[model samples]
Target: MPNNGCVAVNDSTFELHLKKPFQPLLGLLSMPYAYVVPHEAIEYFGNDFRKNPVGTGPFILKYWREGEGLVMRRNSNYFEFDHKGVRLPYLEAISISFIIDKQSEFLAFLLGNIDFISGVHSSSKDELITRAGALNPKYRESIKMITGPYLNTEYLGFLIDTSLQHVSNSPIGNPYVRKAIAYGFDRDRMMLYLRSNLGYPAHSGLIPKGMPGFTDSLKGYSYNPDLAKFMLAQAGYPNGKGLDPISLSTTEDYVDICEFLQHQLSEIGIPISIEVIPGAAYREMMSSSKLLFFRGSWVADYADAENYLALLYSGNFSPSGPNYTHFSNDKFDRLYRKSLLQSDDSLRYSYYLKMDSLALDYSPIIPMYYDKVVRFVGSDVEGMNPNPMNLLMLKRVKKIKNDTYSR
Candidate 1:
């Protein structure tokens, strides 16, 4: 294991010997990867907690059965309290079912068998939400809809590594060509029709909506068929005459979206082919640098700009790192490294903006949309707080009896 730039000074205190003055301490706190475990329990837990788990959280694992469900009981000794000094974890027990099909999960939610239904499925969206992207009037009284920005950015990555360039489609390595493709698609229409407005059209940089450094002013490529044609000519592929068919690699879940993109790009003379692979195989191909054009999403690991920017960092190339597109620019690399060391809060944000601008200029990836988290809960369920990270804090969640509605 690598050193964490931190050292124990005493039993109760520790010091972080950082490589830079600016430390992402707040971001670190929210990451499970940065968690510290009880060292003394290694022997007792056999270096694993598959069966016997331990935590100081608000719930305790009580029962788990394979292919069925799991149950957790509230921790009576939980240390949190409400403003009125009431104990946290108002609910006595929580149950989780291992349902594979999303339709089944939706049915369970409709039947009042679950406390909440989040990440609304496409199949159920029309039934639960109106075409105008509001909760259906019929279910509005019984279901409480909570919607907010989630820290996730979906994009299409372009392989900038010239080594992966095919003799037939050399234009894929050109920034202008990439920008042309970016400008050819209609993100607003996709969000409205395909996603049912579940997300915001990505008009910003790679940084998603609701993140600390995200800004609306960081301009992104929008739909413009004429500009796309001009860009293709500028990239030395007049009317996409010399360009070969661009193949896009993605999973089954996103095939429809890719197909839509293919149709839109074809109007600008860019022939596109859609390849739908299994999720696991698609990931493997991406990690192995086998796919040149692909779909990817970045969900914040720590709600920081660095988490998303790291994907474009040259040092983080795939197989060993997250830079699947193999995008590398010396200026981007220098600016990113400098951003990590700035101590001043305002200056650090400026550095973040500069790096984001560099990404926008290069067009290594086409920003699609920033995902929104949606949750529907029964009226009886209360005290739930919706956050950008979509973290579930069951400590304050509770279910109450209502004679008017059956549950």
Candidate 2:
């Protein structure tokens, strides 16, 4: 086993010898944080290393004009090669523009100024995709839309730890209240109307759709206004008679979704006020456990369901780990440890399901929807593939003009 997570045996050689086999290490290694950094680059760049990065990748940073654009040229001596033994990164250069408005970005792509655009903003979503979640027929010849499951679960969290003063007094501290909030809103409608069906309704659990360990065994909370009313009455706030307004902290980007929730929950006796905080400050407050109720998303750092489940593990309490809700259970912790050490696939997944069901029973978080990676590509480009992580791999991408295709 590594003394401190890893060991360097010699020059050009590094190894991780685990005492007990950990299956998710492979997924963890694929993350950017796992990249090997050269000591020379760190020593030379110091605090400015972000501006002056040095790494062994497919492309070299050519130029970056702050708030404008950045350019990268292909690395001729890149280590990776194709099956036919040709060096990769066939594209000569990669250009990226810092266009703030997605509407303007779509215009530039239509004018053939950019190769591709990712994600559809509300400003341009209706123009490109119909309510049925299909691209408009008018763009069939010039544009292409690619979409798939993204490994992200957006949700609303609660500070369930009774040790916190606000949590003890707040109505959200009541489990029935949380469950009522979960059942009050229509997640399917949220996806259909707000997202244009770009995402899957997260009715299963926090695992999200298309991700491993996600199961329907629990048949999670669906939109049931009647049941929501029942739960509110059980919580001693029938028709919102005695319930106080619960503030939902969020950023400007999610105000629409929050507003949608605000209106829906209000109908079933739970009044919610939207507190639109600046992005960075909101994140800081969320991590510090200052916000009793807040909107957050867990984008998997790896491909495994363990990455998502870690957010609920008691040992990972913030501001240390991702356990923002401070939910703790003995059986859950036992299952988590077992799953982490278990090497068998079926057994590990079973443990995952059990843990997720337990968390749902507690209702510390309200699942919104599993995100989807939507892409808009120009006909002039090819060789791009969408993945759950939304990674941008430009190695084999090529551009076409007239009768010739150029990389």
Candidate 3:
């Protein structure tokens, strides 16, 4: 195999040749994007490939009805076995509903029409989850809240490439201004009120709380309006007197969070304006470097910390890669290169810490919080545990037969 291609040694094996050594190769290959789709399946299904997927996973596509619903049954030919020697995929079938409204989805879950609902949505969050981030005791007997660290870090990225005239003209291009914004707002307060205390304040490096390289070892910004004022003044804008209104572009879903930041930053002498954009359009603008300051979040495709760090790598500058900030640092690049060559976990983590430290010091991005996977499951569901990555692996999940069960 050459250039990004792989070779199949046999029906059971395939291998890829990398130009350089990489520590996270295994994790990278484990991603589902490279899963093999059989030629027979494609030829047979033709335009119906999306509805009739053929893969080696533990589940098989049973049927789909456009936007109405979908069903997947356990693959009888699957080879995997459990610790107890039982064939994998204990659940007979998965029934997925297409409920567009968040509140309606919540109601479906409450009425036993659905097994679980993912994340804390604004519509039904306050009714089910208390202000303290606990499931209200009123429905505790029939509902269970499964919470865990999610491998996602929500943040705001700044276009730090001063070579661009727009960036040079804006106060946001200044490192001090970026650091000021990072320190201006109270992350804990934002989490408590807006997020219902569902996430941890990003008080550490960008690797997030659950990933391996994530450590309290590297310091990050926290609430400090006084320091924010000092940093703003250091950026040559005294009390935001001559500073321009920095617009934070975000999607409609996260407008509330951006508004919260806008309010808090305004009090700290930093005028912040919120730009609400449609989800698809916002993504296009962000990836193409069309926006200077934007709300973004990174979810791990693999378990490696490189996925997050790659966002700041110089070679990954926007339009072609993920580096929206266009931040290039010689020291960070060297460390990142060295990390790829390191096979030892501890040594690689040390490099990660140093790289993260460098990125945080520059303050190209203001990490808002490390998101948490919050699942509201019906009491009748078992083995509903979610991992840090939040990949839905339903092989071990089972639905306890209940009289009230609807699906």
Candidate 4:
């Protein structure tokens, strides 16, 4: 481990010598990030394999028509077997289409042309599900809907880097002003109306639901314009009389939510200007720490609280890692480093909670809502796991013939 996988693995048989105690979870995480590539094929494809993946998994890359679709067939040499000692991967072939239009994809699912659809769009959510969050009766018999928590937290990030500060005396530079902005927006209304009840209002801290370290009791910022106004006043911007206008940067997908925040904060005398940029540009600016205030999200890299809390670590500042906000607290930094050395789950989680709570107290980010993993599967599909990470374990999934819905 100290040599970073070089001298640690000395044998061609792939035996590893560890300098420290082995953490199985750290190694288990490789499953999600791993892909085997043929050494000789690298000279031919170079980096083009992203669109044309070749793997020794349950399926083989049969064909790929860029911007159109791709097809994969079962791997005859796949090693895994089911409980009955039968070969795994029941599906004969898997076809994935690169249709960018959500509406077109939904139509394909409705017509039984596609076997599944993941994450329904707001425009078509009501058409596929009832107001009460259930599959519409018209399609209940033909389709199977699965819903579960997703390890993602969408939030508004406040840039703490002094170089990126909007003005020398900007009100947002004050923690009280950031706190006011956090409590000004109604996340419940945003989730219900703006998101069509697709996600849960993030009343808790950044570690999303279904994560081990998440504590439901830790109530985060709530919508209270009166309190927000008071905080703004305390920060020397009463009624926003002489305060500089705050610019909120976001991409096209989150423009509506940013506009909603703009309207809500305006009520508290904080005028917010929306800066909608392309997604690529937004990410570039965010990574370079060029944006003052921005909308961002954290999806779990692995099933660990460290994956989310690492964003607030002082050592992970922007341009190096994901600490885009440049948030740093002495207590948070100390506890985060200690948590990594902890071998006990409960002890590690306690440290994680402390760091998470500290970040919320600093108001470096306003946690908006936690996303949900929603999948619509044809009735014929079986053994589909609606994992919080939204992973597709096709090796365990099987498709059967059903008269009502067969694609």
Candidate 5:
């Protein structure tokens, strides 16, 4: 009676109406009232409730006034206890105020109005660091700064649809033409001119330098206009003479990168027009295969090399899957399948390397640059560790002395 759609209430009784089975229905029933309530109770409570929190965390929401501020009080009945067997959240209360402006937020941090400041805007990083350095000279050892590599990369992809007008219909569909385009763009110059040396030029294969299976042995598309032109000619578009005008579509955030790429391609005699589209519109066009060429990136969901290769190289596309390039290679697909089934790390990494090498050679998507997770924390915050994934684990965070509130 207990089919895939049936939910078993007990060993003998099958709750067929319920789609998912409850593992500990009776056990959960006997637990404390605090454990039974769902965390998203506020959403179901509707507009009537101002603060309807049902969290098991150390702090409980007390009040919230839209865009103004929010206040939380220590949860006395929280499951976690200190070494002394007392409830955690050593502070009295927490107050979070909204400051939309970065300048005002930095000022608040300087005045000790805020207990912590997580991420600083890219534009404000230099000024914030300078201010922090100046303050550190006077108040030695008061603040702690930590920086690390992020598990993210930014890349540009060429649209593969052959039906769209104004879209490059030449060898863009051919593996050699795509590889030529990858080689045509000077990644080093782009990083210097657009990113201001904040990003490292993508030289190694798709997995990034630090990640496993990544190899400097497998060189990426190097900047060689002559070679690119040669490949283009081989693909039947000699000096991009008879080719249609290439339109590069991307979000506003990456317009500058597209422009830089346009300039680079023009040097190689490829006439590229830049089209600045909104993020949503750009995504739609990419999904429908309407855009000629588009720019995008992916942050690793997990540590596996398959996370990068399978999404872009395998026949997976967006709106349904992760493959945006619409690239499909039987060899790459076979290698990816074998990598997933293999349990040994060394074997898996070897297969991943092979796949990455193929991708680099074929050029489904051009690897641009690896990203870094940059953030600024206030002096009063302690035990704040930054993860490569850029997620904040507030449970491990603690406030230092002169702190009036704790999260």
Candidate 6:
């Protein structure tokens, strides 16, 4: 391992080092030896094999049995201490068991097996809420249900490919075709059906509402089948007779949304073919640009308009690039560059608004709805804070003696 962290290593060098058996093993153990491990067990494991760990965290890894559970013990040698001079992580041990089945996980929670459960799935939200409410009023106060707005936003994206290109050298590049598609669907009605008024209808912009630089005045498309048919016919796909069947791909979670879109588009004379694939396969197909239209969601890596705008319209493509729609506009790109260079937040926000306006006008991808992060925590756990980014901060959390206790 290189002692100096400033220098960059090429891909070939990384691959070569990774392939060396003992080198990779040593690399995994090196962090602990440096006292950088977050838990004690990690270091202990490294030391048992003649390697050493330098981790100084509150917990130490004790045992890990594959397909069973992981056990971590509180580390007395942990560097941090409370104001009263007591060691952190008051609990003696922490155990994590992988329960792939969510229903089983809920049952375990009911049986008092786990201290906390993060990410309550959308399908189980109603049932979980109802059950939690039905408990004794005193018990309900102890059992915390953390809910917050999340940065994640879901959308339907159109794939630009050679098959859809026309001889005008522009092909399916016509903005009218994109606009017609956007207008064909009834987003609000769909949200009511699928999410039960929990979601907001999408406008034709890349920056979702509630984020900085988002504008309600720049609404791009609304539910108007008549207008959609007119635009499609104007784009020369009258009654959808000559146009090829449009394919909409999605994962199982969004199949219902796709089906609703399929029905709505049918009303506008646009035949849509639904392709429901596994999540991993769907992502692979999307990256390969094999699917014409697909469903995707973006969870913000940071709280910035640039994070959302740059990903979808920056004229760049991925692994780090998020221009999944392959949308390119010189005006938007120029504004984005200018915004990044500006040091002042207000100036940057002004440029962001301009960029957002341009993106809405172009109508590349159809925005869906922003998501919410929901979770259920046990009655004994306290000081658990949930952030809008969907991160659970449990460093200050401690188990209480009983349901009535609070810290």
Whole-model lDDT values for every prediction: 0.85, 0.88, 0.88, 0.83, 0.68, 0.67
Better of 4 and 5 by TM-score: 4
Instruction: Tell me how many clashing residue pairs each candidate has.
Output: 0, 0, 0, 0, 1, 8
Best candidate, lDDT: 3
Model 2, 1-407: lDDT tens per residue? 54665767775767877777678887888888888777778999899898888888999998999999999999999999988998998899998999998888888888878878999887887788999789988898888888888999999999899999888988989999999999999998998888889998988889977677777775778999999999999999888897878999999989999999999998887889899999999988998999999999999888889988888999999999889999999999999988988888889999989888888899898888999999988877788888888989888887766564221
Q: Give the per-residue lDDT of model 4 (tens digit) for 206-292.
A: 999988889998888889999999998899888887887898999898888998999988988999999999988889899987887
Clashes of 4: 0
Q: Once superposed on the true structure, which residue ranges of model 2 sit more than 4 Å away at CA?
A: 1-5, 10-12, 17-23, 37-56, 60-87, 100-103, 216-218, 238-241, 401-407
For 31-117, candidate 1 gives per-residue lDDT tens digits of: 766665555565688845656776568889999997899999999999999989998889999998988898999888888888788
Query: Model 5 — which ten-residue stretch has the worst lDDT?
Result: 22-31
Q: Against the hidden true structure, what lDDT does model 5 obtain?
A: 0.68
**Worst window of 10 by summed lDDT in candidate 1:** 162-171
CA deviation > 4 Å runs, candidate 5: 1-63, 71-95, 118-126, 129-145, 161-168, 208-218, 236-244, 301-305, 313-315, 398-407
Q: Flag regions of model 4 displaced more than 4 Å.
A: 1-28, 35-56, 63-69, 83-86, 130-133, 162-168, 238-242, 404-407
Worst lDDT window (10 residues) for model 4?
6-15
Whole-structure CA lDDT of model 2: 0.88
In candidate 4, residue 324 scores what lDDT? 89
Please say which candidate is ahead in TM-score: 1 or 6: 1
Better of 3 and 4 by TM-score: 3
Worst 10 residues of 3 by lDDT: 1-10
